[model samples]
Target chain A: MPTVHATIIARGGGSTFHRKNTCRVLGTPIIAYAIQTCQQAGFIDHVFVWSEDEEIRSIARSLGAHALERPHSMVHYYSGFATQEEWAAQRGRQIEVIAGGPGDVNVAFNCNNFLLRPETLAAMHCQAREDEAVGGVIAVAAVEPGLCLKTRDGSLFPFWNDLSVPRAEHPPLYRRTGVAVTFRERFRNGRMALAPFVVSREEAFDLQHAEELPLAEFYLRKRLGLLDSDRPAAGEGC
Target chain B: MRVTASIIVLERDARDGVRWDARMGGMRLLEHAVARLKGLPLVDELAVLTDCDALCDALGNTLACAGVPVRRLCPTCTTERFDYLTCEESRIRQQLLALEQAGLAGDVHCFGSWRLPLLSTRSWERMYHALLEDRIAARIVPLTTEDPNLYTPLGGDVASGRLFGVWAHPGRDRQEAPQLYRPAEACVAHLGRIRYPQPLTKGVEIAMTEAVTVRTAEDMPLAHFLWARQQAGRACHDSQDGGAGVP
Candidate 1:
């Protein structure tokens, strides 16, 4: 079986950004969750956090995540796919040399969201075990009714109630949940992302804005009994 | 005649159907759990009971397709339409009475409609063993949790939690049946040795009644209580053997 390693591209920006994002998740940094989930998954072999910010490095290490000192040139916001490829090559080679053999087939995924049905991991493992050409398995969420597409003036329109489509012409709807993305050894080139399989929006959460924070809080408290209900009386510290 | 295990689900109304959510929206959070349990080799027989014909048919059909024989009982409606609390008390009472007269050796598991949290088949088996060890006659095993407000500590306030029950060592005679709501103390005293090999004294009855009342008030499911009883039995056995069971 191919060794599966998790590569976490932790964005290190302003302290305020980190604080704000972390507070949204009830004192849990956005990146911390990604790392925590990777640790929790049974199939993941190794986890590497790539970030240039010293604070991010400290936080990542404090959380028991393996931190890689990312190259400063690759830190530009607009660098995009170029940075990923640059980092992937260097990191992949380093890992390969360290092990005195071929590097891991890295399966990169976002650390933002929590898993609703964790059993999906078994499917991924099965795909890997059964098929060799499956570069990686990505989680996809089934399309909700409203998110359907429309073809008018060649522009994609979001479908809502009352819109009717023929059964034979029905579209197979799937949303790409950036929550989990996997890449095989041959595709571990960091400068680019492997063509990801689309996952459903229900299975993914992109906590980009402040309003999305409450959902994260609910996810943590419900899925994981992290918050102590009997903590100090409210309105004191928080 | 050898008897096998059976599952009895007490669903009062469609609102309390097996799919109803106690914690969050959506069908039984553990709806897929039955399949998960069937995958296990240890469990033998499984059954479900409900008031709604549709739900009963769906569950019965699903289990039947999977090659598991399940019995579904559509309780007769009382004055109110889908009034579960009343209809359930009436209908389930009959089933309980019938099972009591049969003198079967197998176990009976009763899960309430509001009980949404699902337990693994292995967990169910573990609970059965636990119940057998505890020698508990009746209690609820919460499949799903409810607002903690629905529960109370004996004298405490009530919350909307789920409940399950298991009956052990049933009686052969149904003529001297006791009322359902009879105080635990009274039931324990009058029907003490009737279910067990040895009769419990009035004092023991009161203590056991108090314990059951408190535990039930907290919404501990019948299966877990049975497990606790088993633990208590083990402890008693150890103490009798001169082990350091007393702490």
Candidate 2:
């Protein structure tokens, strides 16, 4: 079996919420959940926290995971100069630096998504391994379909022909969950034939706002069986 | 500036053969919309645009009951039936032309939809003020905050099943992501400044609660619930103030 590594991308500074990776959700740092999931997965050989912040790295080390100091250049700040393809190439470079071997597989996990399950990670790895032609397998969540539109020059324009049609008849939509498994070789080459691994919307919830933290805590407490019929005491599980 | 507020009713607003007459909190959705617009002091004139004669009669009754003067606008189109998705812009243009012909076209035009019963008077004022600012042709209300990172197109690559053209922000921080504004239910515009194809636009951010737009039968309950909650909140505040009520 090839070496499978899980890298938790926990950047210290967030534009919306500061130090979100280290932000507490049900008494545990958000990054800890991703690390714990990776550690619990049977197929993953190593779990590493890649971050630019010392506090986040220290937290990762305390949680029994390897801490990698990510360079500032790899920490992407949107300048509008680089296209998305260029950003992908830069990500490929970052992956190559972390997992150098040809056969080694790197699983990228966003630390903010605390609800990811070990089974889901293992399933994605197994799918990627079973399909040799595929470069990676990414987690996607279904989006509620409706009448989508775009605005141009202060005017609304519909993407579809008939707005009178029922919303249920619209085609289904899915979005990337920022979780994936990529082989080292596939990262080196620009062309990656990626496969889709469907996940529940709860598992794909990425914490970006302060209001969402309490909701995430609610879900986490529910998962841990700490929640009762009545409202649980504040910091009960913590 | 002369300001004209138009309550736009389209055939597409019908759900289960019911038009904007759908009731919420014991009042028709159209009534709630008209009452809200009627309360705005910035509005110099009020109008209703629709092709349905029955809807026009209903609007006349609604306005008469409210004791507000309104110009009923019936925009004549070349096509017998206008498909909203395909001809929304043309319909709006025709409405504006009708307003112009009636000499009721104000320097500033505010368009309200009957579907948006919860859009607050404060939000309308925000857009109106934003439009009044120099060089702004249009002002629209946007959702409080929406992360662009989560969106993906409908389909993916045929062979690999990988989502193509997915734009993910490089940074984990959402602020690093591009700011995108999805317009809410109402729009305010300076009629003179608007150009043919494109116009300079500004955005006024409103709370997510104020952005409820009822599009389907399923949405009516949520709108009604929200309306009830607002009324309850207002009542509680009024009693707390010794029944003096909001100024």
Candidate 3:
């Protein structure tokens, strides 16, 4: 059987939402959700949390996940001048260094995307492992049509010529989410043939802004059955 | 910079079945559009571009009564074999030429009568200033929404049905995704730099509520509701300021 490894990348110093990964959601740290989900996933052989922050690493260790200390150089690999291929090459090298060696199958999860269920992760892993043609499987959500683009001379033009047509008849647009499963060889190749695993818009929500924290909590509470009207008030714990 | 505001009222089969003269908020939709443009201090001249003769006469009488200096222009180009967009483009070119010949210079801001009812004068002012500051040929208003979904273009390979390029990985701290900006129905263009078949560029972003364009009769109620809501908010704001009177 191929070894399925899950890596939850939680870096510190986010300008948008400070210490977002360590921030509590329904009493537990947000990063704990991804760690716990990976631990619960039967298909995943090992779970790792890659971060440079000592506090985040400590939390990962407490959550029964191996804490991989990320290098400073790896953390600052982003460059506006670098091409996509160059960035991918850099990413491949970084992953290889963190994982010790390129494993059989690698599943990546963003700590901010707390809504990702274990079942979804397992399914993605299975799909990536089973399909030879697929380089990787990533979550994507459908985008609505009837958008317009502005011309340089400031005239409005429709993305879809006819807004009168039924939505079903219009061409579909998909948005890529921050969750992916990749094979060892595909990860190193730089060029990946990604297959889209359709997920609901709610499932793909990433906790970025401080304003979104309440919404994320609401969804998490709803998922935990804490929001159920019939549930006993005293028994409620998420 | 001298600015000429053109209120474009095209005579075509409106998919929403709403005509330019349709009643909206106790006034004709065209009248609301005209009134909005007339209030803009930056605009040096005003012109109405339409195909209908009766509309010109009716609007002429109204403008004459109000003592506003206005120019009425009719497109001499034959509409035969021309689609809606092509026909509209032709009419705009004709109107711009007329304005140029009549000694009008600088930027020509075109306002579609359909969109003017909802857009605020503040938005127009911002667009004009942006145009001047940016030194760009035109300035457009982008429709804003809270939907956080970032999109990717579909690959041409129909058989595989795979997404084209490598996307932002989950490992990255700041995931960058391609943003699609939908244009709201308003734009300012410089007469000197005007080019046919203009390429798309970035525009000023506005709130989704403020970007509502009334396409059909069904959209009328929503427009009315929004307009009333805006008025109510303004009145409340005035009351809070101890009734300082309108600005």
Candidate 4:
């Protein structure tokens, strides 16, 4: 089996619009949730947080994860200096520097999705170990745009163009959950052909908008079985 | 491990106004069940067991075109009986035994036709793997009540309604301290040793519904919402991959 190491990308949210990596969700920093998933996966030999923000890196370190400072040029979304290729190079360099010599498995984990399960990463590594020819495995959910609307030229029209159609008749659609991506050295020119690693519905929902924070809290409680179950419907039984 | 998935489609009174083979989104609930079974690489055989002629014919044609083999059976044990609940349970067991007799050996996963609309593959994986570890496992139905403080009531009183605390009983409390209830579906079993009916036997942990189901008329919105979520995911994937499904 190849050595496995997880690198959590904690940058990008430092922008004015999004929450920082140090933001807490359910008791732990959002970054720590990602770190915990990596730490729990028995297959992973090491875990590190790659971030440009010092506080983010400190939080990761405090959570018992190795911290690697990312280049500022790469995280500044407005700078436009770091092309996709350079970004990949920075990540690859970090991987090589932290573990050296292209480790067997490199998990590109984003700190935004704290709902990711450890079993997901473990499943990807198991698949990676079983088949060397496969390039990568990334989490994705099936989606179908059955009936939706869009506006153009000041008029609203069907987007998927299948309006008034039942969802079951809709085509098989899939979307990425943005939880994690696993790959080996085969990632070429900032691209890798990834096999879809399907995730559960709860794990598919990630944090983005401010309102989602409460929703995330609810789901977290639900997952932990801390949420109460006994409750009657409105207008039904007093 | 060998897996056999069975879709139960029985005829109900039209006056009841619930379609036994209703279409949600764009396909019939039965179609979702059959397609899900076909997608499972572990499932060796598929059976559409029902007394409903429409269900049998529709599946026969569907399976034929899909190049998948199917076994259709009409449940027997035509004995007359009173007490609707007992009859219902007995009939379900007979149908299961009938399906079992039709050569669907090994572990059997049963899904009510109405449930196929939104049960995701991951939920199936969870239940399947859970069954592998234990003798029996069920999929707990997660419900969202109109008010969080209210009891998570179900459409059919299929639940024993005798639960306390987490398993709230509708009869125990009327307007005060609304009881919380967790209604679960018998998702999987070792066919040889167990059979699933409306009220699960006993000692089964109630797992939150990993994949939502279309059980009542009230669930229509949730079904649409689930589709919307999937649509959103597809849009995200499209934007991320530049209009590609996956690389």
Models sorted by TM-score, best on top: 2, 3, 4, 1
Write one digit per residue (lDDT tens) for candidate 4, span B1-247: 5677666554632223455466655666666656655666667776665556765676567766775544555436222211111214564476455656756666555443445455555455555665555543322122211111212112312122111122222333222433223223325555544444543222122223223555566444445444444445556679887974311
What DockQ values do the models have? 0.01, 0.15, 0.14, 0.01
Each candidate: RMSD to true structure? 23.0, 7.5, 9.8, 23.2
Write candidate 2's Cα lDDT for A1-238 as tens digits: 6788787767788645777777777677888888899888788876777778998889888988878776676566565566546644654565556566323788888776668898988898888878767788888776543222345644343332233455555544565776889887765676476677888877877776765654566567557775543222353111
Residue B92 of model 1 has an lDDT of: 36
Could you arrange the candidates by DockQ from highest to lowest? 2, 3, 4, 1
Task: After the best TM-score superposition of candidate 3, give how far the Cα of residue A129 lies from its true spot, in angstroms.
Answer: 3.8
List iRMS (one decimal) for every candidate: 26.6, 7.5, 11.0, 23.0
Give the 10-residue window scoring lowest on summed lDDT in candidate 2 chain A.
A229-238
Local accuracy by lDDT, each model: 0.39, 0.65, 0.62, 0.53
Query: What is the lDDT, from 0 to 100, of the residue A213 in candidate 1?
Result: 47
Error of 3 at B187 (Å): 7.1
Between the candidate structures 3 and 4, which one is better when assessed by TM-score? Answer: 3
Quote the B-chain TM-score, candidate 4. 0.62
User: Which whole-number lDDT from 0 to 100 does residue B105 have in model 4?
Assistant: 61
TM-score of each: 0.40, 0.62, 0.52, 0.47
lDDT of 3: 0.62
lDDT of 1 by residue, A115-163 (tens): 4234454455555444445455555433322221222322122232122
* True-vs-predicted CA distance for residue B45, candidate 2, Å: 5.0
DockQ of 2: 0.15
- Model 2 off-target regions past 4 Å? A1-3, A22-47, A52-104, A112-123, A140-175, A185-191, A197-238, B6-11, B14-39, B44-89, B97-105, B114-120, B136-163, B166-180, B195-200, B205-247
